[model samples]
Target: MTGALTVRVLSGLTELSLTPPLARAIWGEDDGPEDPVLLQVLQRVGGLVAGALDPQGQVWAYLVGLPTARADTQHSHRLGVHPDVRRQGLGEQLKRFQQTWCLERDVTRVTWTFDPLLLANAHLNIHRLGAVAVAYLPNYYGAMAGINAGVPSDRFEVVWPLGGAHTHAPWPMGPAVDPLRDDLPADLPGALALCVPRDYYRLLREDPALALEWRQRSAPLFSRLFQAGHTLVDVDLSRGQYLFRRTAC
Candidate 1:
């Protein structure tokens, strides 16, 4: 996948023309289209807008981001990879490109939010890219559609600190445990582990009430832990656990 694809920065009208279709392809027809005018403004003002193109000149993935209130930080607003070409490392390639694009402009950190129940995203962000979640937003976007339609828009706000020591550490490992039934530890270890359902989307389709119940159960726990100064450092995919560590102030 990497050999055949090229990742490049998009500008002006190009960002506008390409992003909406790519977003729809990834998130389905109900996915809200990002405002092209906003994207153009962001592109002109040194924000990062990039895409992955296949050999045939078709965009298979794209990332949209903008400078945050902090001069040295960027907020990655959206990242989408076309359904047909997913699981091919295109998402990671786009992220690496985004990182390089930001670092070139002296930006030191990039932040984004992701649904905590999506284990694949958890593995990619927390485990692969070395991002840490510092806050949890319950029903963050109110009610969203497409992949996020049924469930509440609960999210984990993660920060990826460029040039940090944590980025270089190897991915962590943990014993496999069923997230649905495993007993959560009462005392916080130097690092603690918590779980999300293995297939939350399916759970939503088959049992919507149970899905909401999971959200009700998790929101308070995540909020309390994050407020207590614990940061989510990694995700163990085999066991479906999101690992959090006590960070020294």
Candidate 2:
């Protein structure tokens, strides 16, 4: 963690092999690394496999993307940063690297899924990077292990347009709904705010039952709102709420 960090395109068996242990380090022992063989094949097929190396040439962060059905779109499958070196902006750095890589290949959009309750990720993907969260997939991955163990794998499918900044106001505002409460507003003229746990991981560790209750209670509400034509616009982390607005008809 001493010298300047350098992001580089990773290829071949040796460089690809470094990811499994790094994935374990970042996501816990239950985390399984993507197969190096498949990664090599992906590289051969115009996919991307890249990493951030520190002064010691250790992979501190890595990102993986694959070509999707649309030639101009890519699905970012995995991104991980070493726990000890987190909060140093490594995640964003890797994503900027991804942005340039995608642009070079004529890819106009990059898509990914993330846990909706994770505030830090919400801040990064929606606020900082300007990705749009469009769909709510409940139990998208079924049961999961590692840090995701014991939680239903609900995810927000986001699309990051590589062409320019994401659509939607950077800081949206309107009426708010506290999901912990049972009542939900029937009508709103402007954007709607939905509360999220400020520190979900801590809540999971300290009060697991409450964490599960929060997910179970919030899932259906999010689904209903999205079905009502609300598109997530921004996340107000300071207030612990996600901003959503009705899609223009």
Candidate 3:
């Protein structure tokens, strides 16, 4: 319509991420707060929100500054995808859009957190997307949701080299962001965290086949993040994902 998938800054009401139930479902994952999505809507939209939309209408995603932080240049933040639209390439487009946003604004770098145990994400962020992982927090969340059924609260802090691109397609994405600031900040812009329910660990401990799959799914990239030099900061207990940051040294 406009171009090869339009990119723009919007206020509210974009993509499945904005949908009330879907947002909550995604946040709850399998068992988060019944209204987790409400928090997603209020916080993400409360401030400036940006998104990317593809011609297929297959995806919707958003980015914004951390909620509690005063909102500044150095510690930029992001969250994305319409969840259902995931595994369809919309996530990649959203990431590219965020990259463009960071570059255009002269922001230093971007940061996010995820469950280190979630093998799927490990692949997406590390092996495929070119981000590196640092910090490993244990039980970051209190197993409040069903999704947290049997996994430890372990989470990884991942950072990407913004300002440039270093990805392949199909198996690899393109356009890695430029290397972030040459120097590190005394403190990062914001914090990253996640939690899974306690029961999920049962599946991992009992299902050798599934746990094998999880390991196979994530190992390659997890190792790569380590090679890339992202560093760990703080790790806690609970059960999902924690936070991480790119390191200067």
Candidate 4:
């Protein structure tokens, strides 16, 4: 499955049927199928359910979103790309396509929750896509399996503004600090940096105890910073750092 990919809306049962296997393959779990009834309802209610197909008509990636109470906003529910085609810019392309799909339907903002400890995802959402983390949710999913099995399902609620201007900030040149390893700076500037493990999944597999320790350690820090009017606005993937800025009230 190579060459130019085509993205289109997945409407009827036939197209939506692919969501379950795709999701299972992406997460490496049999965590039940995506509810077809719900998908039907969402499709009927102006929601966005689309997938990207390779040249041979194989669905390689998919994105699902639902309309929010506000007409101009949509809640991004899921995005998955086949492991084989990842890092080929297909995930980013699917996201860009989703943004365009939302804009065409008069939606300007998209919201989603993602694990804060996943540095790669953090980079993709914040630095690459310009989404801002607005809140920290502790144990958001209660309990789970697959990639998120052991640790607390803490998440960062991100907001992506489709029509707003996004400015790319310069990377921080200060000494990098790992919250899991080093003491946090006593005097934080207008901007502060926190680092997560480059391979959280490996940490989970090799040291489940340490993985849980990371969640226990970072949750309060992120919660406190968010309460103090700080927002995660960018990430430096090279250093596995998440940058938070004090937002003006």
Q: Model 4, which residues run further than 4 Å from truth?
A: 171-173
The parts of candidate 1 lying over 4 Å away from their true place are 1-3, 167-187
Candidates ranked, most accurate by lDDT first = 2, 4, 1, 3
Model 1: per-residue Cα lDDT over 59-99, one tens digit each: 77889888888999999989988878878898888888888
Number of clashes recorded per candidate: 0, 0, 47, 0
Q: Where does candidate 1 have its weakest 10-residue lDDT segment?
A: 168-177
lDDT at 72, model 2: 95
Q: Which ten residues in a row have the lowest lDDT in candidate 4?
A: 28-37
lDDT of each: 0.80, 0.86, 0.47, 0.85
User: Per-residue alpha-carbon lDDT of model 3 for 107-184, expressed as tens digits?
Assistant: 545566776655455555665567766655445564534444544445666666675666432311222211121222
Instruction: Please report how far candidate 3 places residue 10 from its true position, in Å.
Output: 3.9
How much lDDT does candidate 3 score?
0.47
Between candidates 1 and 4, the TM-score winner: 4
Q: Candidates sorted by TM-score, descending order?
A: 2, 4, 1, 3
lDDT of 2 by residue, 1-249 (tens): 788788989868888999999999977799878999999999899889999987787888999999999999999999999988888998998898999999998998899999989998988898888888899999999988777777799999999987764555745444468778854577754577788999887898888899998889899888987888887778877889888878889
Better of 1 and 2 by lDDT: 2
lDDT winner: 2
lDDT for position 172 in model 2: 45
Best by TM-score: 2
